[model samples]
Target: MNEQEKLLNARDRFIDSMAKNMSLYGITHSVGRLYGLLYFNEKPMTLDEMKDELGMSKTSMSTAVRQLQELNMVEKVWKKGERKDLYQAADDWYDSFTALFTTSWRTGISLNMSTINRSLKELHNLRDNPETPDEVRASVKLDIEKYQYALDYYDWLNRFVDSLESKEIFNYIPKKE
Candidate 1:
């Protein structure tokens, strides 16, 4: 194959791999494909341009762009003479992965911690009640210990997420020289 053909083939392979792997992060393959397309584009693209290039409906393009925006994966940019909205993919892969990873992990940790805290509170009450059976109190104590351990783990995870956001994790696990 010619050099241009080989380059196109490599680009397509990258895009295909990106589309497939993005499903692990709860994103649709089509949306990941759109992100790959925008990542390789030299200039910001409009909804119409994306639709024409991807052969996707304008509505689908719009939805995909919105999803990307929520994830901080792409951003809308302005062209001084252009009226239509243009969007550029986040070009920094490290920052992009850090944002995505930290945000999702923090959210999950917060939710699980909240539920665990509530359950711990109720379990504590149950254990303290005089009318409760001894066997039941013993079970509640075990549960309380388990929940406390989970809370500690979540707290550690939150700190890890903080390090990721601050880029302090690189201090301990430096990138390739």
Candidate 2:
């Protein structure tokens, strides 16, 4: 194959791979297409341009752009004297991933903690009830303690992530025993 043909094949492969990977994360096909186009483009693209290039409906392009913005994977730009908005992928791809992962982790931890706390409260009420079985109350108390410990561990993890120094965090490697 000629050099130009080889390059085109490589580009096609890259976009296909991106679409597959993004699909695993629950991104729609149109969203994946938008990402592939933006990632491969030489410059930031406006919504209309993205719609035209991807041959996607305006609504699909808007949803994809909104999702990308929420994940902090894309940034909006405005040229001087222009009313149209442009979007470009984040400069630091790893930072974008980190932001998404951190946000998701924290949200999950928060939800789990809330559930644990509610369970503990219910256990306390059961213990206070005269009709409750002693063995059942004892078992629930143990479970509550376990849940509390887990909640504490999650809190520590959040602190650790927040306290991370950028250089150290990225370069961190666990020591061998």
Candidate 3:
């Protein structure tokens, strides 16, 4: 009914909307709360303030901050003569989205590389063991080759992605006309 009450209501609505959106993207509730606070705050927030406002533990706040940092959605800031670290969202929203999507590809490449390495090791062991049936050995070899090809393809795709800027790629695509 009052001005302060209206402001509080708006803030709550903003926080709820942000939490829902971030949850859709697989972010935890604490992380979403932190983002909501940062999104509305005029200044960067300290961990203590975030913990008190979000009702989260210090460890939860720290972990959420670290995860947001890894996504490049949040960055650390320091003021002159300040002992504590402050955090804020990255400057560009589109760049933040790009960083988030890019992480999936990077993670995929690492996982695929590990799988390929393990398959190679298994193939080597099979070669050394005379008891492996010829048919089974052939099947495993085919699988290994398929994985290797997939790895190579992903490697090439990653290189291509790294080589071009997103803006450039967007401009180069022809219109539906």
Candidate 4:
């Protein structure tokens, strides 16, 4: 009903929205909340500040911070004369995307390649076996064609992800007015 209440409600809603969105991508609520807090405040915040604001234990907050840092979603910054580390959302938007592409995209492709590689081996064996029927051999040939297409796709994607330089991505992104 009051201005303060309205402000708090809006802030909480924003934090919840951020946390929910990040959770969809397997990130923790604590990291999401911290990112929301930093983005909304537009300043670095210390662990104690984030801990008090998010109502999380120090250890939880610390762990979340470390994960976020590893994911390039946040970075620790130093303030003059400050002994403690402060964190802010990554200034470069591409950092997070690059991190995700390099880790998640590459990893997923690698996993798929592993399965496909094994399947190809088995298919080869089936095609080569003298006991294989003509009809089955025809099907295996078709499957091999499809698998080769998929393998080529993955190879292209791996090279694409590798070619992506954060700087280049940032350059192509249109700047807001």
User: Per-residue CA lDDT of candidate 4, range 1-177, in tens?
Assistant: 999899878998988897887776677676788877877766788989999988989999999989888888888898899898999888765667577547777778999999999999999999999999999999999999999999999998887776564455445665455
Per-residue accuracy of model 2 over 1-177 as CA lDDT, tens digit each:
999899878987888887776666666666766777787777888999998988888888888999988877788977887678899887766666666556666777788888988987898898788899989888877887898898899898777656442424645753234
Model 3: colliding residue pairs: none
RMSD of each: 2.2, 4.4, 5.0, 2.6
Tell me the tens digit of each residue's lDDT in model 1 across 62-173. 9999988887799999999999999999977767777777777877898999999999989989998999999999999999999999999999999998898898999999
lDDT (Cα atoms) of all candidates against the true structure: 0.90, 0.77, 0.77, 0.83
Candidate 3 residue-wise lDDT, 45-128, digit = tens = 788888898899989898998988887788899888777889887776666656665666667778888888887888878866
Q: After superposition, how far is residue 75 of candidate 3 from its true place, in Å?
A: 2.9
Model 4 regions more than 4 Å off:
3-8, 169-177
Q: Of 1 and 3, which scores higher on TM-score?
A: 1
Poorest 10 consecutive residues of model 4 by lDDT?
Answer: 165-174
Which pairs of residues collide in model 1?
A: none
lDDT of 2 at 72: 74
TM-score of 3: 0.64
TM per candidate comes to 0.85, 0.75, 0.64, 0.81
Clash totals, every prediction: 0, 0, 0, 0
Candidate 3 positional error at 3, Å: 10
Which 10-residue span in candidate 2 carries the lowest summed lDDT? 167-176
